[model samples]
Target: MQYVRLGKTGLNVSPVAFGGIPIQRGTAEDTKAIVDKMEELGMNYIDTARGYTVSEEYLGAALQGRRERFILATKSMVRDCSGMKKEVDVSLEKLRTDYIDLYQIHNIKTADFEQVFGEEGAYKALLEARHEGKIGHIGITAHSIDDLKTILSEHADQIETIMFPFNLVEIQGEAALKEAKAKDIGTIAMKPLAGGNLEDWRLALRFVALSGTCDISIPGMGDVEEVEKNASVCCDLSPLTEEERTEIERLRKELGNQFCRRCGYCAPCTVGIDIPTNFVFANYLRKYGLADWAKDRYASLKVNASDCIQCGVCEERCPYDLPIMDMLKKVEEDFAR
Candidate 1:
C-alpha cells in the first residue's frame, strides 16, 4: 500500500486507512481477520473511537501481539480535563495498550471550541497524556465545515490532524481541507462513500485518492474483502481517467440534493434530537444490511427521528437546505417498519 506522512505528527500511514465504525457489526474473530488482511496489505493506520460501541475493545483484542504493527488512533467526546484524563485511561484500558498513537477530540462543534480549548479543558488532558507517554499526538474531528475551518485557521498550532467528511458528494470541505494541508495539519477523509449512499466503491475510493485534499481516507471496513479492495487502490495513486471524471460529474448531479453529508449544521433540534445520528442509523439499515444492528443502535438513542415535531428549526440551520423534516419522516418510517 502507498503511505504518506500524517502532517506534523510525521507518522507514515497508508493513504487508505482502516475505519473502525463497522466493526460494531462483527465479532472479535472478524476484526482479527480484517486486521490480518490489513497487515498483509501493509495498511498500517487504524482509527477507532470510544463512541463506536465495541470498536476500540475489539481492535485491541485483534491487535493482540501485533499492536505495534499499526499506528492506532482513537477519539473521545469528553470535554473537561478531569473527564478527558479519565477517558484517556479508559481508552487505553479498552484498547489493551499502554500508549495510543493518536487521541482525538471527537466530533467538536462550533459552540464547543471555547470550552474545549479553555482552562480545565480536554486539550490539557491530551497535552498531559503526550508529555506522560500515553499518547503521541492530538487530533480533532468535526462534522461542520465552519468548525473545521476555524480549527485550521486558529487552532492549527494545537492539533496535529483534522478529520472531516470528504467524498464524491461532500466537496463542501474542499477549501478547508486544502487549508489544513497547507497548515501541515493531517487531513483525514471520513465517509468516503458518502455513508454508503454511493454504490460505487472503486469510484469512491479513487475519487478521494485523487482529490489531493486529504492524506488518508478511512472508509469503515468490517471484513477481509473490504480490506483487500481498499488496500488495492492505494498501490496506484493514478489520476482519474477521462471516463472516471465523467462518472464523477454524473454522480455529483445525481446525489447532490438528496444526500445528507452529516455536516451537523442542522443541530439544536427543537425537540432535542440528534439529527445526523438518526440519518446514520437509517443509512446503516438501508445500505449495510445491518437492520437488526441499526435498529438496536437507534433504540439506544435518547431521541429518534420519530421525535422530530417538524418545527423546521433544524431546516433553517442546514447549509444544504435539506428538507430535514421530510427526511426525518422517512427515517422514522424505516425504523417503525
Candidate 2:
C-alpha cells in the first residue's frame, strides 16, 4: 500500500485514515482495540478533535505505547490567541503527545477570518506552537465551499492543510478542493460518508480516494471492523469503474433532494439560526444514534430550529432549493423527542 503525501506538509499518510468522532460513543478499551487494528493494517494517520468530547483523550490512551507509529492530528474551535494557545496545550495533554502532526481550526467560517488570522488571533498562537515544536503544521476545516475558496485565495500561505466534506453526494467543495491541491495545500476529506447518510462504505470511500480532489479521506470509525474496512480502501485508489460511477450517480439522485450537504448556501436565518449546522447535529442524532452528543451540540446553537421564522429567504439562496423551513421543523421535532 503506497502512502500519500499531505500537501506541502510533507507528511505521508494513508489515504483512508481514522476519524475520531465515533470514539466518543465507545470506551477507552474499544478505542485501543481499533487502534491496534489500524496499526496492524498500517493506517498511519489518526484525526481527532477537541470538540469531539473525549475523542482525543480516548485516542491518546489508545496510542500510549505506539504514538510514534502514527501521524496524529486534532483540531479545536478556539478563535483567539490565548484561547488557541491553551487549546493546543490541552490537545497535547489529551492526545498524550508532546507534538501534533497537524492542528486545524475546526469548522471555520467566513466571519471567523478576522479573529483567526488577526494580530492576536488563533493563527498567531499556531505559529508560536509551530516555532515551539508543539505542532508540526497548521490547517483549517470548513463546511462551506465559499469559505474553502477564501482560505485557498487568502490564507493558503498560512496553513498546510484544509479539511472539508467530500463524498459523492456532497461535492459542492470539489472545485475549491482541487484548487487547494493546485496550491500545494493538503486536502483532507472530513465526511466521506456524508455523516452516515451513505450506507455503502466501499463506494463512499472509493469515490473520495479516486476523486483527485482530496489527498486523504477520514471516515469516522467506531470499531475494528470499520477501521479494517476503511483501511482496505487505501490499497486501491484506482479510478472508479464505470459501474461504480453509475452507482454513485444513482445514490446522489436518490439522496440529493432530502440530504443537507452543509454547503452553507442557506445562511442568515430569519431567527439567527445556523441552517447547515442544525442539519449536521440532526444527522448525528438520528443517523449515528448519538442522541446525547447531537442534542448537546444542537443546544449550543444560539438559535434553535424551533425558532425558524419560515420566511423562505434561506430557501431562495439555496442552490439545491431544499425545503429549509420544513427541514428546520423536522430538526426541531427530532430534538424535541
Candidate 3:
C-alpha cells in the first residue's frame, strides 16, 4: 500500500484509511472480518467518532489484540472542558485503548474558537489531557475549507491535523490542502466518494490520491469487498485516464441538478427547519434502503419541508441557487407518504 506522511504528526498512514461509520450497521463478526481484511492489506489508519453510534465499540472489539498495528483517530463534539475530558475518557474505555493517536474537535462550524480555545473551553482540557498522556495529537474537522484555513493560521502551533470534505464533486480544498502541506499539518479527506453518490470508486479514489494533498482518505467501508476494492486503489496509485474523466463528466451531467451538496449555506430557516438535514435523509431514503428509518426521522423533525413558508430567503442565499421551495415540496410529497 502507498504510505503518506500525516503532516506534523509524522505518522505514516496508508492512503486508504478505514472509516468506522458503516461498520455500525453490520454485525460484530462482519465488522471484525472487515477490520481483519484491512489489517491484512496493511491499511492502518482507523478514523471513528463518538457521534457514530457503536462504531468505536465494534472497532475496539475487532482490534482487541492488534491495537498496536493501527493508528486510532476519533472525535468529540463536546464544547466544554469537562465534557470534552469525559468524552475522551469514555472513548478510551470503549476503544479499550490507553491513548488515542489523534483526538479531534468534530464538525466545527461556528466561530466559537474564541470560546473553545479560551481558559474554560475544550482546547485547554485537550492540552491538559495530552500532557497527562491521553491524546498524542490534536486536530479539528470542518466542512468549510475557509474555517479550516482560519483555524490553521490561528492555532498552527496546537493543531496537528485538519479534516475536511474532499470528493470528486467538490474540489474545494485544493488551496487548503496546499496550505496544510506547507505548514506540515496532516490532511484527512472525508467524503472521498461524495457520500456514495459517485458510483465509480476507482476514478474517485484515484482523483483524490493524485491530488497529492490527501495524506489519507477515510471512506466508509461496511463490507469486505469494499475494503478490498478501496485497498486495491491505494495499493496501485494509478491516475484516471482522459477517457475515464470524460465518462465521469458525462455521468455528472446525466445525474442532473437535483443533488444537494449539503453545504448548508441556505440555513436558519424561518420555520426553524434543517434544510440540509432534510435533504440528507431524503437522499438516504432514495439512494439507500433506509426508507423506513428516514421516514421516521423525517417525521420527528420540528419543521420539515411541509412546514416551509415559501419565503425564498433560503434560495436567495444558496450558493448553488437551488430552488429551495420546490425541493422541499418534493421532499414533503415523497417522504411524507
Candidate 4:
C-alpha cells in the first residue's frame, strides 16, 4: 500500500482509507471480514461518524485487541460544548479505546464553524477533551469549499484534518484540497465513488488516486470483493488509459446538471423537506437499482418530496441552482407510481 503524509497530523496513511458507512448495512461477521481484509492489505486508516449508526461500535469490536495497528477516526455533530464533550466520551466508550487518533466535527455546514468555535461553542469542549487525552487530533468535515475555507481561516489552530466530498464528477474540491494542504491540514476525500453513481470502479479509483490532493480516499466497502478491488487500486497507482478517460468523460456528461451531489447546501428549507435526502433516495431508485427499497425509505420520511410546497427557496440556496421543487415533484410522482 502507498502511504502519504496526512498534513500536519504527521500520520502516514494508506491511499485507501476505510469508510464506515457501508458497514452499517452488513452483519458483524461481514464487517469483521471486510475490516480484517483491509488490515491484511495494509490499509490502516478507518473513519466513522456517530451518525453512522453502529459503525463505530462494530469497528471498535473488530479492532478490540489490535487497536495499535490502525489509525481510527470518528466524528460527532454536536455544536455545543457540553454536548460535544458528552458525545466524545460516549464515542470513546463505544470504540473501546481511550484515545482516538482523530476526532472530527461531522458534516460541518456554512454556519457550523461560527457556531462551534464561537464563545460557548463546541471547540471549547474539543480542546478540553484533547488536553484530557480523549482524542489525539481534531478535524472538521464539510461538503462545500466555502465552509472549508471559513473553517480553515477561523479555526486553523484547532483543526488538524478536514474531510469533504471529492470524486471525478466534483472536481471543485481540487482547489480546496490544495488550500488545506498549504495550511498543513490533512485532507480526507469522501465519496470517492460519487456515492456509487460512477459505474466503472477502476476509472473512479484511478481518478481519485491521480488527483494528487487526496492523502487518502475513503470508499465505502461492504463486501470482500470490494475490499480486494479497492486494495488492488491502492497498491497500484496506475493511471487510466485514454479510452477509459474518454468513457469517464462521456459518463460525466451523461449524468448532467440534474445529478445531486448531496452537498446539503439547500437546507433549512422553508417547507421542511429534506432536499438532499430526497435526492439521495431518487438517485438510489434511478441508479443503484434499489427502487423498491428507496420507495419504502422515502415513504418513511416525515417530510418527504411529497411535502414540497413548490417554493423556489431551496433552488436559490443551491450552488448548482438545481430545480429542486420540480425534481421533488417528479420524485413524488415517479416513486409513487
Top candidate on lDDT is 1
Q: Residue 271 in candidate 2 has what lDDT?
A: 81
> What is the C-alpha local distance difference test score of each model?
0.90, 0.89, 0.84, 0.84
**Model 4 alpha-carbon drift over 4 Å, by segment:** 261-323, 332-337
The residue ranges of model 1 lying beyond 4 angstroms of the native Cα positions read: 261-308, 311-322, 329-337
TM-score, each model? 0.84, 0.82, 0.82, 0.84
Compose the digit string of candidate 1's lDDT tens values, residues 1-337.
Answer: 6689999999999999999999999899999899999999999999999888899999999898989989999999899999999999999999999999999999887788888999999999999999999999999998778888788767889999999988988888999999889989999998898877788888898899889899999999988999998888887677889998899999888767477766456778887899988988998888679999999999999888988888989987775568999999999999989
lDDT of 4 at 249: 86
Each candidate: how many clashes?
Answer: 0, 0, 0, 0
Model 1 is weakest, by summed lDDT over 10 consecutive residues, at: 256-265
Return the candidate ranking by lDDT, descending: 1, 2, 3, 4
User: How many residue pairs clash in model 3?
Assistant: 0
92: Cα error in model 2, Å = 0.7
lDDT for residue 172 in candidate 4, whole number 0-100 = 75
